[model samples]
Target: MIRLKSPSEIATMREAGRVVARTLAAVAEAARAGVSLSELDELAADLISAAGADPSFLGYRPTWASTRYPGVLCLSVNDAIVHGIPDGRVLRDGDLLSIDCGAYVEGFHADAAITVGVGDLDDRARHLSETTRLALEEGIAAVAVGGRLSDISHAVETVARGAGYGVPPNMGGHGIGTKMHEDPHLANTGRPGRGVRLREGMVLAIEPMLIESGRDRARTARDGWTVLTGDGSRAAHWEHSVAVTGDGPVILTLP
Candidate 1:
């Protein structure tokens, strides 16, 4: 069943979202060419713990995965799209690293992701990351009390495709609250007027994952976790957990 959050519950989620936002910001700032992905993950873990929140991605076992997730953050570098495990791999000067993470606090959960360039990047890398981030902003703006759910999807799709980027069909956002993933799976591409009608108390994680230069599809690695671009082009992902309110669409995951 699709769950609606109360104002008080949303308030708690807002706190969780703050923890997530702060942690992600810290990780992004700490990312450097010489740092390993595991080091960044560790930094996020400590930040989440110090804030009295738990890492939502740690040991999370989705039904589609072969085993429990082992990282605090999904650090996807270059062609790796999402769910990229953190290890000893050192970042390079021109790599694009996608950091996806979540935080849980007081029984509520918030999820968000960001793709950043490790150092000096080419035009394509900067364009892909910036375009993907813009798509997420447009998707968040689409949330309205009486609008259809796919309105957000359409907004995201339009921004991505118009920029000549490709979206991974299987990897998208979802409803988020007590659980990291919930009912009403949200695709990046859909008809605007279709799907569930948006309600005042509904909260969703709106994310856009765009592949480099319009390839249209990506591939999953053998780990049954990491997603990859098909044409060997770089990819970028951006996300935010948002709530539909009487006032407007309020982003919970902001710092």
Candidate 2:
């Protein structure tokens, strides 16, 4: 069932969302060349704990996963699209890094992700990251109170496809509330004016994962966590926890 947050409930979620936003910003700042992936995760864990919030992704095990997620942040680098486990791997200059973060506070949860280049990036790397960010902006703009859910999806697809990028199949956004993942899966590509009708108080996480290969094919790592582009082309992801309101879409995850 789709869960809608009350005004008060959304307020609580906003608090959690800010926590997530702050944590993500801190991690992104600390994400530099020569930094280890595990180091980033540790920084995030400490920030979340200091805020009296819990790391939403830590120990999380979705049905499709063979093991619990072992990191506070999903640190996807280069072709690792999502769910990249944080380990001893040190980052290098010019690596495209995607950071996915979530936080839980006062019975609510917020999720968001961002992609950044570790250092000076090539033209293709910078373009891919910017396109993903703009796709996220388009997706969130389509989250009108009375609009259909697919409107958001189509907006994302338009931006991504227009740039000759590919959206990974069956991997996009979702409803978020008390639990991290809720009902009503939102695909990154869909026909506009279709699917569930939007309503006030409904919160959605609109994330767009793009592949530079212009193909949807992808593969999961042997560890059953990290997702990689099939042809080894680079990928980027961006997301925000949004709430449908009478005025318009409210980005809860804004810092």
RMSD of each: 0.8, 0.7
C-alpha RMSD (angstroms) for model 2: 0.7
Q: Candidate 2 — what's its lDDT? A: 0.94
Q: List the residue pairs that clash in candidate 2.
A: none
Candidate lDDT scores, in order, read: 0.91, 0.94
lDDT of 2 by residue, 79-169 (tens): 9999999999999999999999999998899999999988888999899999999999999989897899999999999999999998888
The numbered model that scores best in TM-score is 2
lDDT tens string, model 1, 22-90?
A: 988999998999999999999999999999999999999989888999999999999888999999999
Residue 225 CA displacement from its true place in model 1, Å: 0.9
